[model samples]
Target: MTDAPWSHDLPWPDDLPPFDPFDPAIQADPYRHYAWLRAHAPVVRAGRADARLYLVSRYDDVLAGLKDATAFVSTPPGGAIIPGLLLMLDPPLHGPMRQTISRAFSPRAVNAIEDAVRTLVATHWDRFLASGGGDAAAGFATPLTMGVIATVLGITIDDAARMRDWTNSAVDFIATRIRGVVNPDASVDSYAAMRAFMADAMDRAAADRAAGRGRDTVIDALAALRDEDALTADEADGFACLLFMAGHETTTLLSVNCLDQLARDPAALWWLRAGGSPAAFVDEMLRHRPSVHRVTRYAARATTIAGCAVPAGAPVRFLIASANRDAARFPDPDRFDPDRRGAPHAGFGFGMHICMGSWLARLELRLMLAHIAATTATIAANGRRVPVEGGAFATSGLTRLDLSVTRRSA
Candidate 1:
């Protein structure tokens, strides 16, 4: 099979070390490449013909860029095919927009669902244990994430599964589209179907509210907010769509990543015990192997990253996973020390655009590790593992994690 053109499309200076973020090998293990970039060229120009991306690797530069959002905007330099999404908005617009949907994921709301989330996690773990060994990501993490997001969105678990399929199809389609290839999956149709699904759900929610039979879900809240003229219909739909995408995806990756780390360093399982701090371990895992590898920004105006002149509207890609492991910022950056202490890593992110669901994501991870510690004596690799393809530049996660485990006595 011929490799896709984008796979080797990076245009970098000859003086800099060769690095292809799209390469599968690099995706599987990118620390060496990151170290090279951080040392040789903190900010280097790369990407395809039409789109040029500047990679920022050093911890200082990445964090500074993220903190200075005015200079480095979240919206695409040339705008996106799909607009009005929260992450794709800037400044004044981004603030008001986030306010409208933030209530759904407020600390109060997320904490209230702790019991339900615990139940969901236990149920799936029980099934996985019964089967002896299986893909941890598929069997446990994915379903647990799906269930929590569905509950938050006020939808059935079955509907969450259906939504997840549509999400996968849409993501596949987008990947192929970016590569300028045709996909047979009809992902455009799936994208359209998802939009229509959200639209119809919003209408139903409005009608239910008018009749005083309102449902208390994120969808319902967003729709009501729209009715109050707090947001436009399009904004509400965009927020809901983002919730569907980011909500489950990041959490799934975190759970799988933590599990993978524990399996590799079985000794770390001690940290998950009550005597150890599970929350601290979760933070360290994020620093050691963050799910979000990179975050994109647009130079809203002519700016410089690490002294490199970046023209206005040019794309800037921050190698956040690299920043999390910057030796200058964190001592022994590569080591996975649960008790490692320093400044907080850019795992979730930093500044205005930091992950909105961070609280909930942490809650999920903390509970997951606690449960694993309580129920399992040991976890080890049982078979081959396959990492998720295509999205490694943006997200780090496994599509499959086969693990063997021993259950602790009740």
Candidate 2:
């Protein structure tokens, strides 16, 4: 047992386990830990490693709490592992910000991009095929999705590297809180750097709006918000900073997850070739390998969830990964069934903080998957497992996905 990866980091109790997230024991296999929580402390009152707060790991309980906005506030400056990001904002404010920017993600706006997105997807896959195969996560996954986000924001892929750096550093700080450890993401320098960049962008967008230029850019639209007094200079910076956060990482993680699934099940290629909907495929991929393992909530007032008591101002993680895999809610919870038709998985999340970028995410994934399956004849493999990196608490995933490919006939 001592030799087993699971043997070490035996169990997390009143306090969080020591912050050795890179331990092969936990990463090589986390199912045991998940299973333990599922069976034992689904909604246990655990002490924070450095502070005290509640934790929720059960399916139904997590679902309920996520939707309960009155009892749980999202606006606390400290509740979030990451600060200044909109994910921490609760309603009446979080509500309107979502509604205002949601025009970008409206069903109509998403549908209008179908053709353009498809073209980008096909073009990227063609490039991938020419190379004979590469790390899809880097070469294909990131570019395909980030390109669209960049297009929407009126930025260039040449500039994406800088944004990725900022997003990673920001998320790193956020993860430290989830793991209850030193503040790795607490980079005052990053905050100043990010704030300066966004401030510049906002200023340019404002100038563009006054000139009637950059109409198609999100930056332009955001600048327009400033004119309407809908967003202040600081608020615009915060919002753009958050939008940049959403634009960079998640879709990249999701695209890799989708492609890797298709690669593992070679038959999926045929399924796609048969005109199967990429939308459905993306849904399944999210269920199987969600990017955000869990969403956190803090108690605004004392409340009980499924027999667990949480005090006022207590922080809790919704354990979204566990919720998605709950057998009671999902059929054959452990199995990855692309065709499963029933309840939706907790992939985008539920409740007040549901992901505002979800529709765009789905549209982007669908386009990319369709293009790859149709354009690439064969995807090559360098024979490496998908990389999953562990932070003190949060999981960093899909560092790279190595694959080779042959293009469809010109």
**Model 1, clash count?**
0
Instruction: Compose the digit string of candidate 1's lDDT tens values, residues 254-276.
Output: 88888889899878987666467
CA shift of 20, model 2, Å: 8.9
TM-score of 1: 0.89
All candidates: TM-score: 0.89, 0.85
TM match of model 2 to true structure? 0.85
The best candidate by lDDT is 1
Q: Write the per-residue lDDT of candidate 2 for residues 1-410, one digit (tens) a residue.
A: 11111212346554435323345455434544655667666665433355554546567888888888888776443433342356776766677767776653435445556666777788777787788877888788777877777766766677656776777676665445544557644765665677678778768877876776755566666667766877676666667777778765777888877777777777777788888878888898777677776676778887777666666776776767777777778878787777788876778889878887787788888878777776767664665656666543444357588886777786
